[model samples]
Target: MKQYNIAIEGLDNGSFQQQGCDTVLRAALRAGIGFPYECNSGGCGSCKYEVVSGEVENLWPEAPAVTERDRRKGRLLACQCRATSDLVIRMRPQPEAVPVIAPRRMPARLLEVREVTHDLREFRFGTETPASFLPGQYAMFALPGVSSPRAYSMSNTASGGREWHVQVRRVPNGKATEVLFEKLRPGDELEIDGPYGLAYLREDAPRDIVCVAGGSGLAPMVSIARGASQAGLLKDRHLHFFYGARTPRDVCGESFLRELPEFGERIHYHPVVSMPGEGENAWRGETGFVHELLRRRMAERMSECEFYFAGPPPMTNALQEMLMLEHRVPFAQIHFDRFF
Candidate 1:
């Protein structure tokens, strides 16, 4: 394997080595450079940068994060490009963007797979090294036969252990889910690189915590809630957990959260169904979307708490609009990594 030098145009210490076939963002992050990025899958456009004077190979030219205007401007997503030669690039670097735990590729073995819902499954993997990360950070898995890696949030609290768990929903005709659901089996081997994403539990904040999740987005929210319990944050502060699904069958989280040692009155679980079918007449919990439930239940104290949410773009976007635009919540108070 060969290495290429990556020099940032303006910063004095913005130099790092890009290992063979590694994306620019990964290399910078591995080198402890705080290059801005969120959703390392190239869906958020946060890792876009300019090629100052170097040759690079674009991995996903048609990535939704990169627009025609961005391509015309020669801006490339650092997570989607690899340096072909020694190169200089330019991107805004924020000190806070530095990863809490630097990511490195490691081998993991599938330990177990449990059914969570009709379309969702919980996967447990055992890594050769301890899988350490913040409670809400995500890991990128390199599945066999997949051209690009897929990101999944860790569902378990960080315990400096060798076990990792993620809940994945089967997407219709999704290449990654097809492999994850059909081909992979217990004892299978795969590569995982992560501890990425900026959305994690803020233990220092004195305010109550609110987590909104839908579909597969439940993974990180569960981790956040568990972490809060483990860290004793739930002892004094309330954690409002709102989860939404299409039908009663898709609803999960009660069993998962109840397994936590800190499950108590301080933690409130609100499960809602958006479109229950005719057969789901027995459904008696909250109805409508999760964001609507959040707004309805916590509308008065929206600004008094910290919000963390993840879901499909529509759900996340709706929550963002309602929280930031409607309720006047500060941008810093809400945390999430967009997953397209």
Candidate 2:
């Protein structure tokens, strides 16, 4: 129950208290400081900072985002280190990265589980506190016996209630998915800390919205679409939703998006299969990667819209390349938080 003070080198009144063993990034974010970060799992290297003066415990020394040069330069990932004592760190902070609803850990109980696909399920949880988050934000779940928390995007819009929904795909032999798919049941208790990530819908933007999702990445995209419709943004802006799955059996976006009130005209849904197997004639839909479909459909309009996407690294990387490198879309127009 001890707390340590964390000081930012140059910013005025830029200091926050770290409670217990929380990471530097979480504590700073919890305090409303917009410290730069993306994955929060140490995958994006966006939270790199220099420890001006402090002793911290490295949580993941071999994190993929940390390179040899970063170590040599005394740079550490804020998400992967815990302050052992009062600390002084230096990093550029962006005011735009601050969260509208700061994160706090709370107890939650699983209320329902519905099957979305053979390997995917939708979980409904009731939390101790009202669920509040932007459409595309994600939460970190501390399962009963898992050593580390797993992050999953929320699939439901914030309704000022206690219910939170997330669609999860069962990962083969994944620790968190094993517990969620096999052992977790209704009434199970766990801890959830969230409303994190910066990829939420930007209602102020005048451009059209393009959402590209693959596999379980469909969760946040659903949230964005629903939120936009609810906020009347879809009335003026079109929402083009692109979903990619391995086969027809994996397709679920059609059903999910249909539930939205704005599914009819303004909402355009496109489902593509990446690998439908040989002689899979029963599946009649677009084939090839989702990014390809996005490029083909959007064409030159890609630069005239706002994009939100989530999926495996490969899919996200592909979208990033196609949008930024190929179409020359402004980096600010595309939103996503990297996670591995």
Candidate 3:
């Protein structure tokens, strides 16, 4: 195996090593370097880097962030590139002041599981030592006899206790969800790793916060809401939370949203039901896409606010497109996490 040295400029001249064909981003992660990234699948542009020297190959030839101009300028998506030779690159730096906990892989025992809604279940995993994670980040859980680990965001803020909380939405025939919803029980042991993703709350932003979540996407939003409330970040800023579900039966976190009153009028909650099912209906809440509701509520103020959204691809993509194209919200003011 041919191994080459990798240097990341502007990160204190940090360096790591990668075997031939390994991406620079993977090398950094393996070396415990907390480089900025989201959606490590080469979709999000958070890992864009400028190749300073040596050869590398783009794994995704059509990376969205790498344009013809960018290719001419020697820029590539770190998540989509592999070092073909010893290389020097400068990646977009993560927020210097952000508190990013290093990831660790270890065993955790299932402590409890309960249905939070018709299709969502709250999972509690107990670790030997208290696990610390930024609000809005996720951990990967590998069930017994399962070959691949499944990633789920924590639904609660970091705590001194040794338990991690996650909410999972059952997917049709999904192996992990099948096991979680049917065959898993308290006291079952599972392996977990992380505190990954860069979509955590930026508590220092000077603008109001608007967050949108759909289905189990409410997990990280739960963490952000509670953490912001406890940190007093909502005292002077308005927090408009919009959660969407197919029907009222799919809605979770009603009690969780009810607690926002503790933060006073600055905090607001809007639960949207997109497709109310036929039960001889009596649903009273905003109806239609959550982004449409957001456009109706604060369309004019989007430019002045910081937006955080996480959900299935279609919803998140639509919302992001609306915010960026229609509302003209600055790209810097909007952040997202998509559960694919």
Candidate 4:
């Protein structure tokens, strides 16, 4: 078998590598390069990748993962391919490890609940057992009769690997938040499992940070900023956050915004509104798509910074594309969690 050197555009080092024209999606993962994917079956093209090098064997001839355009362009689903030869492929780059937590279902009592906005709430839970998690991780709150799992990010800093503060947005008809707002009371016993997702601040890589959050996506970012503020972990890096909301009432954790630098002297906060009221005439900020705002500004810093994104799936998708395509950020530098 002939061997060919594979060079990734932004990846600096190559260690254990996967070679072949059609290496399975699992192959890259096994090689220490984990690509975000779901439903590894061909039906879910999450493993979509483009071949940039040597040829590979196609194991699944009829694999539905390859699209007509993708196939034409030499893009193949990693799971459907079998390495016929040495190869180099291009797929979405992975982000710095943001801390994946194993959620434990524990009974918690509501210690305190604060209204960060008209509809946004920050609930602090004290469990009989220490609920440990990273700052930007999440917890799943399961209702008594409801089968769905509602994931909420911890808005507080990680401390002693115990306790957490979760931020929740009250959707108009959200079953979980509705129950939280209407049925739950402080000191009430609640089923909570938490410390999930990848949204933490990387301690080893001190690159400048740019965090964008929409609606409730601010939870994880808030947790991150709060963590930075408390211990100054992000002390040397320039940290900036862009939070977009409908109106002033949608803005939560204003205090953090007010005293950003006090946390590390390298942090800044910018809040924007898509639609403001006559009374909010004093509001001074850009107004439009958050991605557009990011595109227009932050061009120079895009290359040297790390981006953390959370919120609606559309927002994350748009931000991901904008950061990669427009802002020219390597996929590895962009971190995100999708709220579907």
TM-score of 2: 0.97
When 1 and 2 are scored with lDDT, the better candidate is 1
What overall lDDT, based on C-alpha atoms, would model 1 receive against the true structure? Answer: 0.91
Kindly list the per-residue Cα lDDT of model 1 for residues 1-340, writing each as its tens digit: 9899999998898899999768999999999999999899989999999999979999889999989999899989999999999999988889989988898899999999999899999999999888888988999999999999889999997687898899999989999999989999999999998889899999998899999999899999999999998898987889988999988889998887897665668888899998766754757878898898998999999999999998999999999999989999999899999988
**Model 2 agreement with the true structure over 1-340: per-residue lDDT tens digits:** 9799999999888999999767999999999999988888879899999999989999999999999999899999999999999999999889988888899998999999999999999999998778989999999888878977888899988778898899999888888998998899999999888879999999999999999999899899999998998899987879999999998889877787888777868899999998776674656789999999998899979999999999989999999998999999999999998888
Q: In candidate 3, which residue pairs clash?
A: none
TM-score of each: 0.97, 0.97, 0.79, 0.69
**C-alpha-based local distance difference test score of model 2:** 0.90
Sorting all predicted structures by lDDT, with the top scorer first, yields 1, 2, 3, 4
**Model 1: lDDT of residue 45:** 90
What's the ranking of the predictions by TM-score, best on top? Answer: 1, 2, 3, 4
Q: Which candidate comes out best when scored by lDDT?
A: 1
Q: Output the worst ten-in-a-row residue range by lDDT, candidate 1.
A: 276-285
Would you list the C-alpha lDDT of every candidate in the order shown?
0.91, 0.90, 0.79, 0.67
Tens digit of lDDT per residue, candidate 4, span 1-340? 4334444545666323444331445444545555654333455466677667766666665666567887678777675666555556676656542125433457888887888788888888887776677757776676655544466788766676556777787878777877777877887877776555555666556688788888988878887776666666565667788888877557555575555555436677777777766663645667776777777778777889888878776788888887788778887787765555
Candidate 1 C-alpha error for residue 115, in Å: 0.6
How large an RMSD does model 1 have?
Answer: 1.2
lDDT of 1 at 24: 95
